[model samples]
Target: MKSTPSNQPEQSVQKTFTNLINALEQNNYTNFISQGNPAFKEGLTKQIFTHVSEQLAPRLKKGYSSVFLTKLNQQGYQVYLWKLSFKDGSDDIVARLSLKDAKVAGFWLN
Candidate 1:
């Protein structure tokens, strides 16, 4: 089940999200994890990063816009969700970003 919270995150989170998205688009593993927490960085190695990047390359290359959806709080972490709409007629992607202590705990796209 999805938790459709009433509010979206603040502007700061939007900036962080943009940075993360840019890193992904550039396929820079180091920059991608630059804002991540130790655990988050440890969980993703270069091989894993390459695989995911390969899978997302097509969508990432195209112009897209993201709409803030809602935020969820879990175990002292803030999890924000966004919907990405592609200009090339690809399917939308659901982006989830979790932050703990002002650092990225994890990020996923589905």
Candidate 2:
């Protein structure tokens, strides 16, 4: 299904991780980089963001934004919003890595 960002989590973290692992188990990791157009890649990245955000945000108190993504450079990984909130009035973040090797990575939300 096409992924749409929202203000909440769609499932649990364990479930998101399991789905990612299952997807990897079923396909080669390098294929996402080598086999798709930019739009397709973006779509995949959004899906990952949605899944991770849905799984992690509920454990925190502040509101998390549904969309956040930027490619830092040609090689550096793009940052996608898995979760974004306030902790002590500072940005708290949980995100997924969109490098050819997809994985979860946490960072300061700001």
Error of 2 at 70 (Å): 1.8
Candidate 2 similarity to native, TM-score = 0.25
Worst 10 residues of 1 by lDDT: 2-11
Q: Which candidate comes out best when scored by TM-score?
A: 1
Each model's C-alpha lDDT?
Answer: 0.89, 0.41
TM-score for candidate 1, please give it. 0.88
lDDT of 2 by residue, 52-106 (tens): 4454444343432333343343355433344444444555555453333343332
lDDT score, residue 110, model 1?
91
Clashing pairs in 2: 9-54, 10-54
